[model samples]
Target: MKKLLVIGLLTLFITPFAHAQFGVKGGLNVAELTGRDGESASYKAFYHVGVFYQAHLLGPLSIQPEVQYSLQGGNLKSAFTNYDSQLHYLTVPILAKLTVGPVFVEGGPQFGVLLNADQSGNMQVGLAEDGTPAYGNVSRPATGSFKRGDFSLVGGAGLKLASNFSLGARLVAGLNDINDVQNLSGINDPRLQNRVYQVYAAFQFGGGK
Candidate 1:
């Protein structure tokens, strides 16, 4: 029943795009977490692959919607300890695009559904409180109940390299918090939200022109 509902919704949403050009896109993702109270972290390398439809609505104006599987997460080094957190998401991004000659610019909102979350590190022992240990023991392969849904804003530009191939880059920033209680220990630590930079190439199905 759930599968049927999703298929129905996708069909409805993609009907308009069916009349336009379709393509496959894959990209590299540099992701990290940011918020008001999270630990210091570094960007982790990930990737996204998906299909998109570009429907031209007017002169030099079009609407593009994409469905992709994205891997997003970060690594943390706090208090001489290291942690790695990784997340998998199914994302849908809708963009309003403007094209001139061989260049195009687009911006829109991206919605994501979390498929998986994982953490590996020496962080289970918790952080120091007043220079004292907080957790009692070290746990391996720690788990957290993170949020399932994510919302973000994305803006990007692309250059046509040929009749059928294009290169692009995009910036994606989270609009909502993606934190869990299990990851927080004190009142001073901040939350976690996603920030990613993407670089990709697209291959059009019908000559990509």
Candidate 2:
């Protein structure tokens, strides 16, 4: 069912290609993990790059669908260790846009497939002879414990400076728990979700009026 939905959306996005405007976008992402038990998480800065197609539906309204490759995740400090998790995803967002003058607002549903997940950090190994704590770098694959799919909502507002240039900011909030770890002890675990803030610039090519 989910796979079918994804395929349908992809088909819809490309079906109007000849009449749509093509654009490229790249941005910075401030990402973090939400709903962690008692542990606090910090934001991790990452980036996203994508291409999109926009088609006018009516006066002041348009549909924009995008394909993006994003790097996300968060940082955590637990006990004597610091951890940074890197999550790589391929995402699709189907947005409905409203334009007024040079300003526009958009909101949409986004679907993502996780490509990889990894954690790299430093852990306190022992105490030095001088009584200072010693640390060692550690790295591990985290993909096995996380869900393969991510569902989210995207919302933003932006300004079009010209026919081919624009700037925007967006917020993407995860709509589903992305943790897939199994607890054999029958204890409920905290749900993990993705949260991100983005600022980007877009450049468009000729298409619609």
TM-score on alpha carbons, each prediction? 0.81, 0.81
**Candidate 2 lDDT, 24-74, residue by residue in tens:** 999999999877664568999999999998987767888999999999999
**Candidate 1 per-residue lDDT over residues 106-209, each given as its tens digit:** 99999998887887765636546666556432434323556888999999999988877899999999988777555454432546688999999998777553
Q: How far is candidate 1 from the true structure (C-alpha RMSD, Å)?
A: 7.2
Q: What TM-score does model 1 achieve against the real structure?
A: 0.81
Highest lDDT model number: 2
Q: What is the C-alpha lDDT of each candidate?
A: 0.81, 0.86
